[model samples]
Target: MDLTEQPTFAFDVFSKACPSRGTLEHVTGRWGALTLGALYEGSFRFNELRRRVDGVSEKMLSQTLHALERDGLVHREAQPTNPPRVDYELTPLGREVAERLLSLIHFVQGHMDGILEARERYDTARGGR
Candidate 1:
């Protein structure tokens, strides 16, 4: 099909029905953010990932990995061990996204103190929740 023949759709994240919005949510959700950030170090097995991500349940990790795998960001490989060793790694696309996430994380880290202070001031002004 020629370029002209290809149909195009508008992508507006503000729209309630945008697919990219859902993808954005999935990638930046607490579990997705932590999982991808941890994988930036290297591939890890299921338990290893669980330990690295901190506070992620087995079900959440499994679901996150599967979602990322579906999005072509994460790679899942299984070794033929007696118990079957499954390793998870970031694809090049995933690395690109992970790098962006790392930048966001660093920004949050640098701003956390101020953020907490703001929260405190806001809470105090509101008579403490």
Candidate 2:
């Protein structure tokens, strides 16, 4: 933890002032979700992550990884080499949340057909174009 950053021992996400809201947003948002899911497979460097997550621009992926790293969900390691190398992987806390996210994704995938059919029915009834 940085000396400039204060510690929050207790937090309430329902409250607008809670820091957890920002953390939750980082973990659950589009790029965050995909990044964590990809890292769950194995460690990856910057370009590899850019490839694994389709359509995520360099800036967006970097921002997402930065947020996750700040939140203690991802570990960034810098290695000493001629050119230097950095790799990212899930911390223990990160692995816990990644597993949960993967389970939620699987659950949604299992019901996708049903969800699509329901959406079609609703659209038809509502005269959607």
**TM-score of model 1 vs. true structure:** 0.88
**Tens-place lDDT digits, model 1, residues 12-123:** 7768988878777878999998888999999999999999999999999999999999888899999999989999999999999999999999999999999999999999
**Estimated TM-score for each candidate:** 0.88, 0.88
Candidate 2 contains a number of clashing pairs equal to 0
Candidate 1: residue 22 lDDT (0-100): 70
Candidate 1 segments exceeding 4 Å error: 1-10
Instruction: Give the alpha-carbon lDDT of every model.
Output: 0.92, 0.94
Model 1 lDDT, full chain set = 0.92
Q: Whose lDDT is greatest here?
A: 2
What residue runs in model 2 are displaced by over 4 Å at the alpha carbon?
Answer: 1-9
Worst 10-residue lDDT window for candidate 1 reads 1-10
Candidate 2 achieves a global lDDT of: 0.94
